[model samples]
Target chain A: MTFDVEIVRWHAVASWTWNAGDDVCGICRMPFDGCPPDGKYPGDDSPVVWGVCGHAFHLQCIQKWLQSQAQTDQRCPFCRRAWEFKAAAPSS
Target chain B: MIKLFSVKEKQKKDAAAINNPKQSAGELRMQKDMSELNLAKGTTISFPDGKDKLLHFEIFLKPEDGIYKAGTFHFDFQVPTSYPHEPPKIKCKTKVFHPNIDLDGNICLNILREDWKPVLSINSIIYGLQFLFLDPNPEDPLNKEAAEMLANNKAKFESQVQAAIQRGAYIGSNHFPPCR
Candidate 1:
């Protein structure tokens, strides 16, 4: 096919989402792409975190969830098992 | 044809929405939980203050099996602003001969007190309430007399439960309501 118009300037667009099992955070009930009630930004400010139990929640949401419980009784919100972070944090 | 007033109306609505603002985190989460709430078999929920009031509601559990079968138990739920973080305050509205439920409607469920976690939703509470009817835990109980009876004499406990459900009977000093 012959090109009718010459290409001068092109702008590329990209999109992304959290690679988590659930679409919405269980704690804040907000979408992973959206920020929590206390957060301002989505991908930058609010990050999705995973537990050793394989449940995913926003970093801020999970932190708040953990802080609500006593230190001795701290456990995963999804499962009653002790909560352990899957990794340090996402690169995003 | 282009609509001229639509933009103005939308702007007015947006302004009103901004004035009202979004619901609090707890309310939002509660709304989500209520929407996704999967009540156990023979369990139903009702909101006395209408749907807008999601924090306060009632659950009616009618266990189809176990000792509490064919009985309708009413439980009142008052969810706090720190819900999920703090478990909802649940009270048994229907008086029954239960070891875990006291005469004053106070319940003795571990999840409602110590084991509550943010991941646990209203569905979890409903299931827990239903389980209490199926298996009344005498190990951790609010009614000491009922607990002792349940632990010591299984036949006596079953008969007492049946009497309480069938005809408002008095076991000890408290009178139970005939709920079926």
Candidate 2:
């Protein structure tokens, strides 16, 4: 007697979600799991970063937004408050 | 082998999507934002293009304090397809004697220009516009004469503001349409 093994593809929906209820990144209006425009997947690039204001965005989106801002008004684009990272590691 | 697997995946996705057509990411976000809009007192929102066209709408601000008190002003908000990333283009449809707002209906607001962020909702923009009526910023004004008048003579500025509220009050030469 012989036995055969059957393989199946399993799918899971992982939301790059924050404490906030929004499923999409507020900056890019793109789904958290999906990559930003002209972006690659499953890498250090364009990962989600959370602000101290409890808002979250794509790392690349916030970086580009912050660069164009003046020093006096260097704040999060979403809440119009001072930009503070929830996780210190994301800043580096 | 890869091509065959990709075709099979596409077919699976198509079958899954057939039951319910997907809305663009922008539409879903807009829906969420619109549903959560918390308009202030004396402020009302209207959509001329029906409920389906969420991108175009008008905000009526009846500033009940300061110089603009009791004056009804209409503002047009046009949200682009690339919203959240891009700020909405806002314009004053009701011409009033305002330093930050011009005769051509262009407004000088930081959020509408360089300072806009994705986190800002329609409620924030409405408040910004209302703040202009309560305290018009002469420091950064779109109307030079209005700014100058507001800076030089407080009495004259008050008079001018009153005159502007009157039906068809002429400021020097140009006529301001009577706002109801």
Candidate 3:
């Protein structure tokens, strides 16, 4: 699928303007955007994490997302889909 | 408005987390190994459960040449978190009577099993599967009877393959998933 930069930019700007004090990437719901200066969000090259709904996040961010929701229940913080670590097979 | 709402939610969640740092480190990783993926034409990927669930994805393989021409097979890939380090578990959800695939929908492909390597990508595995349909190997047989027949008698093997594919029962075995 072709990504429309203008559409993404417009959405990002609009989201920023309305939220006023949020640092989330509107599309991913994650706080990091790989842009410099503030750098609250982890830079790219961090281990990528995927939700059961197919959305992805940086490992650090997702771990934090999961930790935040620990009190209520165990579900994906974004989509609430049941999430589990894929079990690794024994190495030969 | 929708975009704004999502950003706000993210911020609220972030704030809530700062106050309570105790939570499960629930993390899942399912990125396809790009270096190993060797997709050919007519193969496509689908999320099915939106973009959030990448571990449970589907791949459509349409063979252009083989006894199973013009046929579409669906394979479900369940990638474990240790992917790239460990091979994803793949199963042929489509049922076809072949020497390499047993009646119970189990596939006897090497890449899916002992031969898997971190260097192999989704595309490479898919191509390997497609190759099985195009050229059913009898030497390493999952369906030993079919393999024996094919190895011993070429004509009988062809007849059995044709009969099974045409939705006809072979040797009292009734019903096969329609592939026409």
Q: Write the per-residue lDDT of candidate 1 for residues B97-156, one digit (tens) a residue.
A: 888998899999888987777778898888888888888999978888999999999899
How high is the CA lDDT of each candidate model?
Answer: 0.85, 0.77, 0.60
Query: What is candidate 2's TM-score against the reference?
Result: 0.69
Second chain of candidate 2: TM-score? Answer: 0.84
Tens digit per residue, CA lDDT, model 3, B39-107: 678877887887656666888887877676666778888776555445677778777667898867688
Give the alpha carbon lDDT tens digit for every residue of A1-92 in model 1. 88799889999999988887578887877898998777988897898888887788898988988787778976777777788889754455
Name the lDDT value of residue B80 in candidate 1.
89
Give the per-residue lDDT of model 3 (tens digit) for A1-92: 89866544433333322111234432223344442112244444433445555544445545544564445564554465675543331222
CA lDDT of B37 in candidate 2? Answer: 90
User: Per-prediction DockQ, in order?
Assistant: 0.60, 0.29, 0.02
Stretches off by above 4 angstroms in model 3 are: A1-92, B1-38, B159-172
Question: Is 2 or 3 the stronger prediction by lDDT?
Answer: 2
Q: In candidate 2, what are the lDDT values of residues B1-180, reduced to their tens digit? A: 999999999999988878665554455557767887988787899999998778889999988888877778999999876666678899899887778999989999998888777777787788899888888998978898889888888678877777777665877677776675
lDDT of predicted model 2: 0.77
Better of 2 and 3 by TM-score: 2
